[model samples]
Target: MKKVTVTALSVVIGVGLLAGCTTKNESSDPAAAGNASNGTKPKVVTITVRENTWGARKDNFIEAQKRLNEDLKAKNVQVNIDWWPGIDDDELVLQATAGKVADVFMNSSVDIGWERDGGLIRDIDWVKDSSVFKGVPDSYTNIMKYDGHYYGVIQDMDASPVFISRKALTGLGWTGEQIDGLKDRVDKGDFIFSDLVNLADDAKKKKLVKMGFAVEDKRFEGWNYAFGFYNYDADQNKMVLSPKVKDVYAFWSDSVKRGVISEGIGDIDTDKAAPMFVKGEIFAEFARTEFYQMMREANGMKDDIEGYNKWFKDNVVWIPVPSAEKGGKPASYSNPAMIFVGSKVDDEKMPYVQQLIEHVMDPDLQINHTIASGKLPVTPAAQEDARFKAMDFYKDHAYLVSFTRTRPAHPDYATFVQGFTLGVDAILTKGKSSEEAYELFKKEVKQNVPADHVIIQ
Candidate 1:
């Protein structure tokens, strides 16, 4: 829970290293890189971090590295961070295979299975016993593990909920009370998925918006939303083509047929769809909390919870993903950003890597990051921390964690996701029935999923 000031340090060694080299060393003093006059040189350990340009992730790593250096200065060991921003997955895979991967990097929960399978990452089984990782829930850790070995520690948690445009609803003649009442209905299972379709259909018929609903164009994300809405079972540790899955396909197909969903929904990327939602061109869409922050920033609100809620309270409505049926469990999808040590890291550097992991996992530091980034905390301790509970944002949105579920953590999870997306696409775009699509999905899963990974029942 130690805190550090955000000082801009020259963390990048040189621009030339970005062309596929594996080292970038940042030191407090430039001359410290050379041996001291006493014939003793400090050991420099370079920790490479790969992340996208979103959120405060890059800053978090830099600050953590600074703290790490402060902690290790007494031991005569200094840690340098090589920051790689905006590196895509394909490039990361190439780097990893060529033995040029970063020592510690950020990755999605879905990548854990494949990365472990490819032997691109190390197994940090000792993390569970560490004090820094003490209160992290198994639900988060399970998603970052392959088989029974821990490969990463969750950096942040997030949930995807349906965001509604209040202007669109009010334009459709709904009163403020009515709009406010929608959240209660959604929570109590009174506002089912079919109800969403009906509302969107009415809005479309009345021409309240050009599209009644929109979803991310990525098939995997869309399927994840559907999986949550349908309450697809994950406890069984196997992919079961549940009969309930048909309801999900039917909903998409029906919405498309009714012309309530965007025709270009399959092609509408987040950047394109976000503006449409803000302008009231779309009534409702499934999106994450980060998107809410983006909208607030776009509207010129100050970057704080008060500013966000002031605008959200008046202009937008947030609700959980509706259940498939009334009185059923409402659910939503969540995924965690994780940090992993690469397979190529030397044994001599493992302890230092653990120290860096521990520094970032501090509950106070995590709460601060959560406040700045709009991501949920990874540990129960952080969620229950005094600072977290005092924030208006946490007070309002913490209820979402109750209904959030991560995708199944099976070793073939990636394959299952791809197959599910393809099957859903077939039902929506092709002239295929739900039965045919399910059959094709089952065939794909069986053919690709390893036999040992499959679970009966």
Candidate 2:
């Protein structure tokens, strides 16, 4: 158990040249293998694991590590988990390129495909095939793969679903049944995006809230998922715009034109906007339950779990983001936290690494971590736990985990987001049509991203 700071540095290693640089480290000696198979004591080995700053506390990891080591005594393996506070994707990428990453680290699956193709992460499909990993569904495992090869394990995820202020609707003289009806429609795939706009517009007209809806433009990927727009074609290795892109663009543009969405929303940061949501300044917005904790804190209930739970029960309601038509798919997307084995790990330590990852993915450990961190559990067994089921927030949103979609696993994903955001803003504020916005999107991607990397259509 160590704490290390990964400082900002400029470094780039050519992943193309480093591809296939890793080697399997299984013991060649039959005597050693036989001894371990027979439960004979072998020399103890330690593997490194890294956890990000945001998810769970240091004490939680330390306690988990202690328990894990106790269980690993029979296998003669141990883990040294390094807690890296405030290390983001940029720093992690730099560490990977420099061959200085830990054996395993928690990261977002959004970058797994990029990292795999860049030769920064180890091929972990073999670990997925092991008995310890067989319980994880293919839907979750598929997101961690690149070119049909697994590079990571999905640890925890939260769908970016829309949250509505029940208090605001109630203030508009709506009954509980009416509010529940809306939620039911949303859940049953009958409440389309147009219905959302109409509800928000009604709230706006009645002055129930200052803004009817809000979305942070910087993280525009959620809307794409809600709209069922997958931008990348894996078969062709090209970035293809969804045929319904214009319809989604028009939906936002119309929301703005009708004053349901206010001006300057492009600058709305989640940190600031989340409080607005709690204060009932906006009727609905995309968020995770983790932010409901923030809302509780904003309402002066930081440590009062009981009060917070009561507040959440009375004021908040969540639903999958509505789609284009009634009976059409209403979907949510996940940016799942993942466990990745670094490419630089030596072959000899692979056995220990597997054991460490298996322990980390254990159902009890996953349940404990999600409870401590306030994230949705990834494992089916963990989801069925009574503690997880007891929380109204988790129970209400748990269904979202079943159908959560992931973003395109390309290295230039940031580029695609930026390009899409630019196009969207043009339609919303610049008075450009969807066709014009499409051109702007194409130009932005072409100028900044590698040409061969994406086929913009």
Candidate 3:
């Protein structure tokens, strides 16, 4: 057996994943197991994975690991998944540089392309033809690739839905039935994007909420898709700075000018947005499904689905971000958690790594994990699971999957996001005009991203 050298961590947008197991009973121990019925010793290997979410908390991944070991034992081999402590993104990059990343780890989808380019992760391009990928959505898988090769296996996908406050709407003279049917209206294209702002403005005017809509000032990746702006054209192999981007900037600036949104919104972080919702300062805000779960935890209902559901019964509802007009297209942003293997794994250990991938991608395991962790599933089977469908935020998020878009997994994606965000920040925080912001956007992208890779129309 080859020595294991890589030690790593898994980080997902402030949310957690799988846990570790510590029991060393011989029945489950790879080293203790041998052919008791015969006289032969079976080959055994241990795989290391980083523990995710809520430091030191036990999670469903332990159950999945147990199942994998049982299955491997049948093949005359035994496996043990040893879990390591988690680390932040900067540390991950540093560790990757030192070739000390864990044998298995996971990170945000947008980071994989660069990780692949830096040769920090292995390219499992064969997943394109593997049965293990069956039922996983392309929106989840596509963002795990870089330069047309798969470097990560999707753990889960999340869509940003516009969360509306029932209490605020009721304050604006909306009837109970109307509030109940709003999601269906948005689904059927009866409620357009403009309708969202219009209603928010009305709510503010009525003194029902201090602000009508809310968003993070410095991070605009999710909102870019929410407004139907795609910054890159993969087929053309160029970044697109269309007129639509300026339109989006103009819309936000106009909203701030109209006093329906907070001027300080541009200064807040994503974690701060939810509290504005809870405090009734905002009538609606674009948020990922995990935001709802965080709310549940905050309200002292963590892990108690019944209490969580009751707490949100009439408190809030998620709706698709409005279409441009009736029957127009709907949009949302999706980001998936991607599991990766360190590139330094030796040939003898590669097959076990492959087995670990297959185990992680299993639809049932994936579905159960998401249900426990308050995330959406990546596969059709997992999406349809009764447990997952039972979550309060499931219907709207699942319905919007057809319209969700993912960030391009370009090697320079982090740089592109920074450039795109700075442009938006200039308008929202720096008080720059839309024209000024547009110019800044063009300059930033052109100066940082390869010229041939960007097209500023």
The candidate scoring highest on TM-score is 3
For model 3, residues 1-457, the per-residue Cα lDDT tens digits are: 0111223444341122222223322225643358334636777677767668531112445555666666766566777666676766655565555445677787777666566656668887767877766766666566766666788877777777778888988887889999989888877888887788888999999888887777643445555654667887876655677767777778777877887766577655557766767777778877676778767766667768797787686788678677765776667786667778888777788777777677666667766666666677677766666777676467446766656777676655666667767776777677888778878877888888787777777
Report lDDT per candidate: 0.68, 0.69, 0.69
Q: Is 1 or 3 the stronger prediction by TM-score?
A: 3
Candidates by lDDT, descending order: 2, 3, 1
Residue-wise lDDT of candidate 1 within 357-457, one digit each (tens)? 88877777787787677787777777878878876655566667655667554556667667767777786677577777777777777788665555423
Clashing pairs in 1: none
Each candidate's clash count:
0, 1, 4
RMSD of each: 7.2, 6.5, 6.1
Mark the 10 consecutive residues where model 3 has the least summed lDDT: 13-22
TM-score per candidate: 0.82, 0.85, 0.86
Please give the lDDT score for candidate 1.
Answer: 0.68
Residue 284 in model 1: shift from native, Å?
1.1
Candidate structures ordered by TM-score, highest first? 3, 2, 1
Whichever of 2 and 3 has more TM-score, that candidate is 3
Q: How close is candidate 1 to the true structure, as a TM-score?
A: 0.82
How far out, in Å, is residue 191 in model 1? 2.2
lDDT by residue for model 2 over 1-457, one digit each (tens)? 0111234344544243223332333212222332344566556454455545565634444555666566665665444554433355655555566665667677677776666655557887676667765666666867877777878877777776788889878977889988878767876778888887888899889888888877643556666766767777777656765556776687777877789876577776667777888788889887665666667767888788788898777887777878767777777776677778888777787766766666666667767777677787777777778888888887777777667777667767767777888888887778787778777877888887777878655
